[model samples]
Target: MVIETLPARLDPEEAKRVRQERLERIGSWLLPLLIMLFAIWLWDRICVWNEIPRYILPRPHVVAQTLYTDAALLFGSLLVTLKITFLSLLLAVIGGVGLAVLFTQSKWVEMSFFPFAIVLQVTPIVAIFPLINIYVDNQTAKLLLCSWIVAFFPILSNTTLGLNSVDRNLRDLFRLNGATRWQKLRHLRLPAAMPYFLGGLKIAGGLSLIGAVVAEFVAGSSGQSSGLASRIIEAGYRLNAPRLFAALILISLTGILIFLVLSLVSHLLLRRWHESALKQER
Candidate 1:
């Protein structure tokens, strides 16, 4: 017998839901770009209307031009800043995750050490930079230490919270199953802490950049190896607003890119099962 099968139809609600999701996805990218263009246009118009000199506030196009013209110098400084930011973030992740794991293992250790971490976090880098400079003579090491101090606390605190936030029932179940500490950590706590760790990492990424820039500002060390902050300072001294704006743009773009990359990592890692990254059927 030959049978003809008709094509299945999607549910009306599901079709509407899919369309909404698509629109939302498109809007997410489109809206920010539109707003940015509008802002740039307004800025250019304001500069033209007021006859403002480029020395004070260069038009966006002028800044763009400067970026193109000074790409080599700007990018070199960017590379230096990026190196410190990334290195600090890496160290923060290692130290924070390791310490958090240790905290989970023992309350006494956490009580003894967590306060020092808190002190480091709460104390302004500027306040401690003098001491750092006095003791650590290397410019690069100072930048790394300052950035690491700024980035370290978020990861440590967030990961600690996540590790301790495990569901009692689930933990009891694991215990009932005769799971070892390592097994429980590997299978349960780590997975549970993933979201928190990612959240902290996103914050730390921006903080690392800020710390690197601030450290550079404090160091005030001139030369080719200096970061974007040095360029900003030099531009200020020379009254070269365009170059300063260009440097600022690079820093802003760098921060945005770091955030986007970390967010993508978080979404990719969590989307499979975690609620925060999962798409809701609203």
Candidate 2:
């Protein structure tokens, strides 16, 4: 006897879900863009109607003009700020992960120094910057230290949590297999802690930028090599509203870029195995 087979088809619900996802993604981008344009339009209309002075409330166009006119100078300052932010972030990762590993290795050491980490986290960078500036003669080093202070605690705490949260079963399996301490750590704990580390990294990136700005403001060092923060301060002192707004826009955009880049790195690293990076499926 001959057997007959028919073609398989996509379930109706699956098709509906696919279309819905596409539309949602499109709306997510389009709606925010539309709202931003509308707000800008309203701002321009209000400024025009109220006859506000440019020095007090410059129109969006005026800010755009300022951004373009000063792009070269502003971007150069932005590079300086970025250097401090990224250098801080890099150092925080190295120190945080190294300390976290040490803590995982020895409970006595963790108990001893964990309080100091908290103290650093809780003390406002502004309050600390004054003392740091007193001792740290190199201006760049001062900014780096302040930014690192702001970024360090998150990575250390999150990584510690992740290291301790590994599957008990897998740990037992490692023990049963007679795995050495280094082997178990390399094969099990570090992998489990990756997601937490990335999450902390995202938070650290933004905080580092904020710390860099705060340190710059505190330093108030003026010259050809001043960072964006210095430009903001200079604009404020000169009552240059347009320039101030432009500088703020650059900082905000930089923070956004840093966040997106870190998020992409996390997704790329975790997408194959981690549930946090996986999309839920019906």
Give the TM-score of each candidate. Answer: 0.91, 0.93
Per-residue C-alpha lDDT of model 2 across residues 79-177, encoded as one tens digit per residue: 999999999999999999989989898889999999999998999999988899789888899999999999988999999888889999999999999
What is the C-alpha local distance difference test score of candidate 1? 0.93
Query: Which candidate tops TM-score?
Result: 2
> 1-282, model 1: which lDDT tens digit per residue?
223663377688877876998999999999999998999999999999999999999999999999999999999999999999999999999999999999999999999999999998999999999899889877899899999999989999999999999999999999999999999999999999999999999999999999999999988753544799999999999999999999999999999999999999999999888888876553
Model 1: lowest-lDDT 10 consecutive positions: 1-10
- What TM-score does candidate 1 reach? 0.91
Name model 1 segments beyond 4 Å from true: 1-23, 221-225
lDDT of 1 at 237: 93
